[model samples]
Target: MSGVYLIGAGATPVAEHYGRSLADLASEATRAAFAGLPEFAAHRVGALYVANALGDRLAAQGHLGAYLSAAVGLRGVPAVRVEAAGASGGVAIQQAVQAIAAGAAEIVAVLGAEKVTDQLDDAVEAALALASDAETEALHGLTLTAQWAMLMRRYMHEHGYGPEAFAPFPVNAHANAAKNPLALYRFPINADKYRKAALVASPLNMLDCSSVADGAACVVLASERVAREVAAEGVPLVRLAGVAVATDTPALALRADPLDLAAARASAHIALGRAHLGLSDVDVFELTDPHGIAAALALEAMGYYEPGAAPRHAADGAITPTGRTPIATAGGYKARGDVAGASGVYQIVELLRQLRGEAGPTQVDGARVALAQCLGGVGATAATCVLVAER
Candidate 1:
């Protein structure tokens, strides 16, 4: 297999693009991705992988691969939409890497775009519910937030904590997001505000939940030969290094431990092993969690923190911008605005910025090796990638 490098990365500011269509958002991101790189052109892209989870339900459209490829001027390119619920974008990236590694394409474009705010809140909630198990979860009115809330309650009960234990995650996210101009909620928040925030579900307040917004993120991935040809002097080359994806039981009720993100652990460990690196070698992580509790659960599940310690770890400022395990550096879903299916792509874009030393205030100092993981529907599907910056 050939090596794959991220040749270019770009994203639109996460927000409620009230008038923009899904294709428009995707096109803007695609153009920005290729903006400073003259070596690759839109027409020259060998394949296009589009990730849109609610285009059909929210946008009232389908066949996003062709629709978006043409919208972005990649006419006639072999394009297909990748849907793995919230993991769509990360899975799209995984597929793009495989294509380049298998010599199926020299350069492939991965675009993760989602439009949710265009519809009503209730409508969006129902659409998001579809990501959960239809017969067991969604059909019984188990919304995604409710699923996470259940996990939060169980974690608190098991760990002997109150509802406020998860505040630090979002507080840190908002603080870091204040420096991210592209982030939606750029203001820093405090525990007081978290305490006053309205409840989305019992134990999960609005502040704890990620904003449902509309945005797109895109990346241009190239083969090792193409990357060498496009290399700019004095700039570090960011390689994908290793990637692995895994899935768990779709229904949360079937899991041995509802809080155990089994797929997340498997994917991250497998990818890290492939890169021949240990957990300590990672400088940063871009983990996809819908809220603070999800973030806490993800950290523990991925082995970043011991079980029942992630909340306290965050509370103690261990997950800050300069801490031992910095996460959600680009504001994450809380501050960056969760564009659902496109979040995985956003994670990659943010990681690329960190690797390039251009993350501004959210930059993890001296970050070299990073992990980016995205989960689909209450941790059912997990996609993990190890990125290495070669100086």
Candidate 2:
């Protein structure tokens, strides 16, 4: 709130784009962010942060931060790459906040991109490994979907929720994604289709799982002085009220309460306390849904509802953009394809657009307080950020 701030953001589709690589897509998104920020040129950027999910798997892209920096013509700037499973983007944002908080850089650019479609099956297996407890979870043949199935099944058994109870989240997300030009899955979905789709892991059908795709998103942060001097009213400038990242026990089975997300609880609590607000004060909420259970449990753990009632709220049309409390108006990872590191950045980008009144038809009317959550692995690591619109 005192120094570092977001000045601009960008999100681009990742499906098929003239045969561009993941690095290429990231560079393009970075350029788009810079283009969006007509106030600051490339040379003004002092540091670069690139959030990536599959840099090592695809093309062995190990040093993508430097690769992207040179590609954007901002060579020689200190570059750092962040990989926090799905929370990579949130981690990237946190890194920029620290750099600015420590007075290391005044202007920073953060980008998140994933080239997933290139190897779908391998990616799924590898992504599951991130959650694998070498001595426990993975050794027992537990995959992400398998763990999610157990969590979803447990929630249903304990709360009387069923597969049909969670349909509205993807349904509403698809409805909103239809309006977002950058979303990969723009087509609207229906309950019947979702119900009929083949089940991958019980209680989770094809529609229940987000599609595999590619995409990139970017954000530019400038110091408070630069933010006030750079732009006029139309451009969105949300103050980074607070950011908190925390970790919990790695093994999900040994967790005090499988349904109780300690990471999310700690992260959101710190963020809200730092921002001097509470859950009810937030106008918008964007929680990560690497799997459907993630959103349900996160909503419950973050005090939105008791553990048993989240699914009911979701099915009752409570989390849609048009609902009483709008959530993931851009479809989130549930409907919008999850681009790993880019997923959190996309959430921040959509929230920023909503705050600026630039989210075409999906805009939330008078959004002021926004919160974003990104969870890593099967809830082992999580990050939360709170953004407030400044007058």
Candidate 3:
């Protein structure tokens, strides 16, 4: 198969952009991505893949492909919208890579954008709940937050842990976000602050969750054939070494084991297998984190740590920007605020900065390979991507 290279990427600050429309955010990110390549012409873009999970439900707009393509000034090209709840961005990137490998297009542009601040807080919560299965999950009034809470409770019961064990995840994220200008929460947090946070669900406090906000991220990919034609100065070759997504039962009740995270595990194995690398070979990992529990489960399921060891690893400062197993170097979902579907794209942007040695304070020393995974809901869907910076 032909390889796909990440040419450039961009993103907007995760915030309540009530005044900006989805098109505005998407176009702004696209412009930033294009700005990195002054010699790359707009005519070379063969397709546009826009990922947005809640544009119609919250913003009264749909067909983001046509909307954003026009906004980005791309004409006479194939354009489409990709949706898979929060995994939409990662899935869209997968689609673009497949297009390039199949010789359908040499250059593809991917944009993940979401607008939710237009609605009231309650309305936004209701809209975000669309990630749940309508027939089995949402029908029972189970929100994503409550589902994660259940996971946290069960993990604690099985592992003999306390709520304080998970505090390091959010605390680390906030500390990293304190240095990220694009992060929504620009302050550091400690375990005491986390312990005192108000409870939203049992064992899940307000600090345990991510704030939903409007945001956009864009990335341009080209076939290896085209990549060699262009020179990206001061950086090594960043290739999409492998990409895969896996699915499990959408209803939490139907899953063989609710805490297994089988989909996430399978996706990670497939992606890493194709990359010919293991978790230890990855310099950094970026897992979607709506809640700290979700990230802990993903880390274990992806074989990064023992089933009950992820929280403890966080406590050891192993997940800090320059730690042994660096993760969420760009504040992650906790402090960057959850951009929902666009978060997958934002993860890529953050990793690209690390690979290029452009991440000032958060730079993982000598980052060469990275892993990022985004989940749709719980573990119903997981899209994982492995990137390698070839020297």
Which stretches in model 3 have alpha-carbon errors above 4 Å? 232-235
TM-scores for candidates 1 onward, in order: 0.98, 0.95, 0.97
Between candidates 1 and 3, which one is better according to lDDT?
1
lDDT of 1 by residue, 253-295 (tens): 9999888999999999988988888889999999886688888
Please provide, for model 3 over 1-391, each residue's C-alpha lDDT reduced to its tens digit, 9 standing for 90 to 100.
4389888899999999978888889889988887776455366999999988888898789888888899878856799999998889899989998999898998899999999998897787777677877887777777888889999999999999999899988988888899998999989988998899999888999888888899999998889877776554433468999999999977788887899899999999999998888889999888887678988999999988899999888889888977777877889998988988888899898888887778899889999999999998787889999998867
The residue-by-residue lDDT of candidate 2 on 1-391, one tens digit each, is: 4566778888787464537787688877887887766655467788998888767775366898888788767789998789887788888888888888787888888888877666656555656566546578876667767777788888888888778777777887788888877877788988888778898878887788766567888888888877877656456578888888988876788898887889999899998888888988888888887566778889888888887887778777788776656787887887667777778888888888878777778887788889999887777778888888886
> Which 10 consecutive residues of model 3 have the lowest summed lDDT?
228-237
| Candidate 3 positional error at 110, Å | 0.6
Q: Comparing candidate 2 with candidate 3, which one achieves the higher TM-score?
A: 3
Residue 6, model 3: lDDT of 86
